[model samples]
Target chain A: MTATMPQAAVGASLSPAAVARIRADFPILQERPHGKPLIFLDSAASSQKPVQVIEAMDDYYRRYHANIHRGIYHISELATEAYEEARSAIARFIGSPCSAECIFVRNATEGINLVAYSWGRSNVRAGDVILLTEMEHHSNLVPWQMLAQEKGARLRFVPVTADGRLDMNRLDTLLDGARLFAFTAVSNTLGTINPVRELCLRARAAGAVSVVDACQAVPRMPVDVTQWQCDFAAFSSHKMLGPTGIGVLWGRKDLLDAMPPFLTGGGMINVVRYDRTTFADVPARFEAGTPAIAEAVGLGAAVAYLTAVGMERVARYEHELAALALEKLRGIGQVVVYGPGIEHRTGVISITVGDIHAHDLASILDREGICVRAGHHCNQPLMEKLGVPATTRASFYLYNTPDEIDALIAGLEKAKRIFKLT
Target chain B: MRPADDLSGMDELYRDFILDHYRNPRNAGTLEAPDASCEDLNPLCGDRIRMDVKLHDGIIEDIRFQGRGCAISQASASLLTETVKGKTVAEVAALGKDDVLANLGIPISAARLKCALLGLSVLKRALKL
Candidate 1:
């Protein structure tokens, strides 16, 4: 199963029984829309949750539903324990040395904003340059733009090659006067798995703090912050098969402790008088107000499930899926697949056919109960760089199968016929 | 390809006339130094349209729209241009979203309602209606 197989027979290469067991864990797979079986290929937008993650959240709400901390009651103590345990679970999941470095925010957008407002506002000075890449999602791009405008800092872009990869030729000049470097661990559209450790080290050597937007990377692959030595990383729980409303922001404890808190409230403070307030330590200082209790518990369960399945196996499975998809997609005439070679990519596929609008293609797929994302995918700059109005994207996860890829090919053929494209 | 899953259902939404309008949009350019022009972008889906109108004696003497988006948006803009040509400012102002949908001859989903009406939105903004 390690070696790539032809697209038509890739399904049987892996252990079918094991893949079936994994697929059975997710209840949403049984859903039939328009009296047809669902073939979800839009995991990049948000992944479907498994029963284990669902049960964990349900159990939390059914029993031990209480405000965490500041309660002498038994349920409160249990709730607090569960929340803190989830934090530790996530920290261990990402291979962070300490749990205190993990702070729960709303989503990846908020996680980036937290660093932009707190760490960025304090450290970024006038005339400083913040280097970013062209393929960044709006979440990672906009916050830095705002920070640059507010702090009178300059912004530079690292252009992506036509083959949908970072241009490594001009890295030295891009790093030259950059105060901070923010980049994605894995491009959501192109599925470019970046060299996180090397990029982080380069930024560190240049006296710049690196922020890794791992919203697409953490679930699909293993991420070790200690090895990467990046200053900060952000990811969303929902995108990784956990419930929405919970995201993680991991930073070096020293950087987090020194930076000002993002939001001010009762829970995040240590001493609050009428005059001024002192914040709590690392994680607590950033986690203001009552957080998403059940969502955190669900995310903890998701991490546990992934750990049990093993990230390496998950990554391998996704690679197979991606390779097969690329082969099949390329075989279809006039279908241009956007991204690196399958060897350097994940299961995310962005493609376009001759004169067929992305939205129209998505609609046609939806009619066949195949789910795919259309439009700019929150990467308008990337769309501009690619010279396409929009692209139809189909992303995969562990629960996906080769049969679904076949259905996608069939669907595209049908769309081509309908549009008189062939 | 199976005939049962043919584009008959899609034809209900994207009629031939709509596709024709999208393929050959009328007035798909800028009215130079127009009396009014406004660009409206749908933040959620990223569909954008800018309507430029040249007014004379409180009447739209010429109008054009420019932007790239989905078929529905571009076709709707083309259809809007066809519907409002030579009409008085008050007459165009009195027209509403229902008029465009009626002329489109399709049932629009809630998610695509924005795309269908994006042209109208830009026109309304351009005329301050």
Candidate 2:
């Protein structure tokens, strides 16, 4: 593996010369809604696709749209090779040890479920403990809850500090009896970037397997598995400038070899018999039936685009946007922003007004052609802990600029007036 | 867009009555003299409220609530407390969709109607009326 990059190294910031050219690469950003320029700040929900990713998928379907691995024909071979190439691309993107370690699933939800049903069902015993955080997306929390219920195992939580970052001191306490520590590299709702490397080191000392959900982190920052030293990590393509219906679950090779296949179907089996059947190797064993071939190709293209621009540049750009967003939101005295202290937090920011409901706020914002997500964001437990029904979140991405941040502030001001929040 | 009075879509749903109730909620505190009190939540959207009904001689003498949630929920609770203040358990049990609509002074979306009706429904179940 590449020499472990400095964990806190701030790489080369994007040159002013590069910003205009990079913006040109995404065609959809040129679109307008309500006769106003589009200001997309919901990338945490799903990222906008670049022209390269769109063209790559279109090229695949137009040229060689054939079922993979089973066909003897030329087009079939090409399709199979393209699909496998995507797996390799994803493997390299995350700095996984081997291409075979990358298993493509439906989404991060399904990827985590695979671990829960296959690995968790077999390994988690009645007295075991699964450590989760208070700020996980439902994808990471529910699976473990189900596992704990069925296996009679206990589900513990690492509490979030008042500033929204994970309280590692609490994590140290919870690590004592935990067999699995499922943590998110970034909080989707709070925008808090967790200290994953440090957390993983603690989990290792505690004799627990570490699983990092990088669905939000991979899009905003550079994620290197070798450096983070986690046993497993999962991320969705749609959240990271890639297509929907394609996600990657990267795990340690030895662990992958030990865990049983998650789904049972044709594509994953090596041999079949009436009495017994043999499953394929690490990845194929988990991928059941026909896979999301074109989506994977699009994701590969998305990774290529992010690489060309550089993840460090992406992180720097998003951090600047987050700071700008925070400053603007703080200026509105009526608005209360959650997750404020973490310096390395992602571009996402969740907020609520003094008395106005988030739904009312979101509806008013939508009228102005600004898109923001207003709900629990699939983190209901976190909402309960925060003592709020819901919060409106505006998550930024690579295409977002300072002007858009200004517009958001202006739109929010308008919302306050419309809702009589002022 | 239809005139603000038209209330064609969600605009009709966010009525002034609801906004008023949300702003100045009645029975906003806990009811300690309650025979039964059940806290319910719409776990999907995290709208939670505790209902307190002071039932005396099979009649709702007083009712109050104490919880935090969306405007729709808080407004609904306020309207419910107002509507069922002196009504019998049987009458409150008969409170249906139309009554809730009339109280809100506008129609609610299918998703939010549940939030508007959560307190009433749970109260009905608790009273067995």
Candidate 3:
């Protein structure tokens, strides 16, 4: 019943039965691309929604569709309660100390920008250093670059190793005198799971604030902000089987209270009198007019579904899947997979077959109804470091199966034959 | 499972000649002290091309391309070199995306249009057209 068992006995943990049960909740799994069964392997980009998440949003819009906070009518009150309840659920899901510390934005990109513009503008002075990693997705890299450029601050990076993991040997030197140490808990391009707790502690020891881009980590594994001891963390709902346009920014209560408001507008103010106005509380002050109401409900349902499934099981299942994929890819002889070995990575596999370009490989895979992302994956700097124009990435989620991995292998074989690589 | 006919598009795209062009590009190097040279990148996919051309009497006397990318991009660059060799810069300027598509002789999806058009864009830039 565990992933440690042989392949025949391993399906018990997120087993075929469990995966099939989970797959049934997703209606999009029934889709056929090019008259072939859809094998979704791009969950790292955006995960598909389950019926629970979809229904929650639908039911909210159908029954209690009203603006929150201001309306006191029956349906409005219900809508407000649903929105607040979603916030509380998300706060609890990430193990934040309090619900008020969770701020809802459009997505994880906005979450990072919120901290960069609000907390960064205040804390980061001229000549201050902002430390990052070479493996950062542009979402996690660009905001800080912009902030550093505008604030006259310098930016330093922890280089990625040959195997694509962060080079931690240089951490002390990089964190020295750094004002903020912002890094991804799991690299979107490399799939390397960083030691978030250790990195946070090191940043604290260096007298620097820590920010975590948990977009990939929060979906695949359990994330407890309180345990990480990081000042701020950001993650998106769409990558966790919820609707798009809603994400969470979890920060320390004192930090959230002290930071200036990111966007000033209606629903985020306390006293507005044609002149200047005082802002509302932490979460509200960050969330501007007309937040994603039904999207919050969908995210709440997603968290509930994940809670029911248990994140430890998801993490273990994905680890097993990644190990199986790496083994199979190694057997192919021509396939080169990126990132660290199975022990330090997730189910995201970026690969190159012989000299076949990623786009060409993805095109052939599409003919087989296989969905894989082929590009820099929004990590052009990392792509440069890896010395490849592009890579074809196959990322697994709870619904993916070993059969799908076999299909991907078969598709790659077809691509090789087309290119005459063999 | 689907019928084999549904997947014929891949064959058309990776046709033997296209693959031949990609594997063994016609003119795949940089020109030394070239009359005109330009480099461009498909930022979305990170495909890059640096084109160097030698011009004589307003004609592209010699041209070569050096870069790395997908089969479509490299093949298109190879095919473009053959198409514009010994042609007047004005004639190459008149060449459009349709001409490149006709040379490629395959249907390209909207998503892959950038990949297919990258060579021509770089060629135009090299000629300063």
The numbered model that scores best in lDDT is 3
lDDT of 3 by residue, A1-422 (tens): 24343342244258688988999999999999998999999999999999999999999989989999889799999999999999999888889879999999999999999999999999999999999989888999999999999999999999999988888899999999999999999988778999999999999999999999999999999889989999999999999999999999999999999999999899999999988999999889999899999999999999999999988788878877887777778878589898997778888999989999999999899989999999999998888778888899999999999889999988887787777777
Q: Native contacts retained by model 3, as a fraction?
A: 0.82
TM-score versus the correct structure, for each prediction: 0.95, 0.87, 0.96
- Candidate 1: docking tier: medium
Cα interface RMSD of each candidate: 2.2, 4.4, 3.3
Give the per-residue lDDT digits (tens) of candidate 1, residues B1-129. Answer: 466446648767776787788778999999769999999898776778999999999999999998777778889999899889899999988888799899788888777888898898889888998
Each model's C-alpha lDDT? Answer: 0.88, 0.83, 0.90
Q: Is the docking of candidate 2 incorrect, acceptable, medium or high quality?
A: acceptable
Question: In model 2, which regions exceed 4 Å deviation?
Answer: A1-36, A340-342, A419-422, B1-17, B29-39, B50-67, B80-129
Please list the residue runs of candidate 3 whose C-alpha ends up more than 4 Å from where it truly belongs after superposition. Answer: A1-12, B1-8
**How would you encode candidate 1's per-residue C-alpha lDDT over A1-422 as one tens digit per residue?**
33555343343233668789989999999999776799999999999999999999999999999999898999999999999999999999998999999999999999999999999999999999999988899999999999999999999888899889888787768999999999999999898888889889999888999999999999888788998899999999998989999999999998998999999897999899899998899899999999999999999999999988888778878888888788788889989999888766888989998777888888888888999999899999899889998899999998889899999999898778766678
| Candidates sorted on TM-score, descending | 3, 1, 2
The TM-scores, chain A only, for the candidates as listed are 0.97, 0.96, 0.97
Model 1 misplacement above 4 A: A1-14, B1-5
In angstroms, how far off is A187's CA in candidate 1?
Answer: 0.7
How does chain B of model 1 score on TM-score?
Answer: 0.93
